[model samples]
Target: MTCSEKMGSFYSGITCQDIPPHVMKKARLTLFDFLCVLRLGAKYTVINPIIKRYLVSLEHPEKYTVLGLKMKSSLEHAVLGMSVVSHGVELDDGHLSSATHPAVAVIPAALAMAEKCHSNLRDLLVSIVVGYDCMIRFAKAINPKHLSLGFHSTSTCGTLGAACAAGWLLGLDSEQLSHALGIAALQSAGLQEMLHENASIKPFQVGKSSSAGIIAAELAALGSKSPSKVFEGQYGWFNAMSNNDYRETDLWDRLGKHWMIMDTYVKLYPSCRYAHAAIDSALELYDEGYRMSNVKNVKLYLFQQGINEVGVFKVPSQYEDALFSVAYSIAIAFQYGKVRIEEIASNLQNTRILEFADNIDIISDKQMTDSFPREAGSRIIFEDDNGNIVVRENKRARADFDTPLTDEEYLLKAAQILENVVHRKYIDVLWEKVVLSDQKMDVKEIIELMNEMGA
Candidate 1:
């Protein structure tokens, strides 16, 4: 079968039992990471205003946790709320190969749907694995150059993943699932132009795509018919959007044998994934006790892919720009020795960060450029005042799944986020329930608990 055919079959036929144990464990970690990011995102200047505006306009009550907030909305509203929280901070998980924020797009839909259905924890876990699988598979089929051409994978591939997860949870047959995929394909949209304009529409793309996928699945379940060959038919997604043909067999090459979730990397810093390696390199120089002032110039050697994505910010005037700027991220890490979420939000425009950013230079290495997709690496060289030199090269950061955060560290991060958005006591309770419990809880009860905790 072609890649598209294999993916179609997997989404249409895979059952909960088909999920491997290692995949399930990774899914759980993803869940915890998603919640942590969501909680922290609730306070993001861009995300909070929109969520509050929507909540104020609501006339009826519904069930579903709105991350750190206490307000509950309908299932659809819940998906939107959670999605905004997930993507607002730009701290969600991203695929190293695809450069797509799969969890941000897929997790919100799964959580909203699972809450609406009151599905068991096992079922929820299974749905997340399936959702991630579909998202990564679709992303893998597309060319990275397509994104450079202004397409946003978070919305495009994310919609298909959301549809697959919703279809699975809704108990739709393979035919209905295919129909849902077709419906989802029609609604997918997000563009790289938002980054250029520094618009807040980026997160909206994630929420909109996610909610749209749920709507597609619901319509399919209600007997709505859509084109069967949404992926491979003439003038379909690949041909229309990318102008490239895909090998459909690549979609299910390993199926259950290899898990996509295991390849996902969590963020230690609340910046773009493209900026992480540079930040790591700069941090290493700091750990070696190099003074920022003594550094005459800093040169960053990055893969072409990283440069294309984050090298846009030659001079960043705002927080969003700084987040996407390799120069800014490296400068801040070298100056302060660390990059935290609060620092990104508040100090992106600080005079010191700007001055340091001015001294930083970024260049692409042809050798490193050749290793694209399979790995993300960076090399930093520092020139000191006395003609001294220091260098550090990191193949990958610690947050990569292969070198994941410890359980205590994960919980501590989660707790810190909760403390920022909700009451400490409530966060403690919710943490216990999410981490220790095996039974499913009502979506309504979950919302109520968050409300009591000052949602």
Candidate 2:
């Protein structure tokens, strides 16, 4: 079978029971994380507001609730807005191998489509699993080369994932879903240049991917025809996007035996995933009683991809700048012994943090470069004026597939993330009514609760 047909059949065939219990549990955690991040992200001063304003200006038909906005919108508008909001804080769940943020790209579209179609909890969850698999597979086949080519995997590959999710929720047959996947492939567009030219475009691409995916699925449901060989065709996604530099990995080796969502990592800090190991190492130094006062200079060694993405030594002038800067993230870790949203927001202009960030140097290490997108390792060395030196290395970040966070840890992260943005009572109710429960949920009710309670 062709790549799109294989993926279309797989994405269209998954059911709630076919998904293992552990995979469903992971889906619940991802959904809960997405909701929390979406709520907190609405309060962001940058990208969310621009999206909200632009959507409101369009005045799309009101069909669904926009979380944290206290407004109603069409399914497309809601999906676009929620998807963008989820990534606003930079804490969305990401997969290492795929190099994409799956939740932001998948959940918003799936949930919005579920609500629109009145799909049960089973359909929603199953669609999520399928979406992650399709999106991650597309990315795993093309990235870090795709990323090296200045394409944002989350935005590009995510489009296909979102289409798979929406098509499954819409009950499209395998053939129809193939068309949806093809349409989504044609619509895929995101640039890593957004990281420098405008960070707002990062989340904007995510939102657009989700919205465009829904449109693709809807078009396919209307019996629209699409190119069949969207993946392996002569001038298709693999060739055009990856410049024929894609890997030939088995896209369906284990299939249901190995769900891609299981390999996804949850973020502990609200910065780029590349910066997480550096932050973790810095916190370890802080825990060892190494304060900034005693440290003279710091050097961080990271993989080439990490250095290319977040290892810049520039001082952050705003919140967006800080999110992608390993130097700034580490500075926050050492200065406060933690990297919290509050610390990031309050210290954007702090001279101490900026000065410390200036002293920090990020170097690309050959060993780490060779092991990247798998190990994501980082090494840090600290020196004192008197020649005292300390070194630490993190082979992999916490919350990785191997070192997954417990359910309690996930809940605690939710609380920590939402403490300032959402009311305490709402957080409690959400945890109990939505996340902790396994029963079928009224999708509309959950969306309503989010609309009323978020922000």
Best by TM-score: 2
Worst 10 residues of 2 by lDDT: 433-442
lDDT of 1 by residue, 348-431 (tens): 557877777777778898887888777778888878888988788887766886787776777776665555566667656665
Q: What is the lDDT for 101 in model 2? A: 95
Q: How accurate is candidate 2 locally (lDDT)?
A: 0.84
Worst 10 residues of 1 by lDDT: 1-10
For each candidate, what is the lDDT? 0.74, 0.84
Q: What is residue 336's positional error in candidate 1, in angstroms?
A: 2.2
At residue 41, candidate 1 shows an lDDT of 73
Highest lDDT: give the candidate number: 2
Residue-pair clashes per candidate, as listed?
7, 0
Extract clashing residue pairs from model 2.
none
Off by over 4 Å in 1: 1-9, 54-65, 415-431, 439-455
Error of 1 at 87 (Å): 0.8
> Candidate 2 residues 6-110, lDDT tens each?
778877887777998888888878887888888888887378767778889987898876675667788888888888888878999999988999999899899
Superposed model 2: Cα runs more than 4 Å off: none
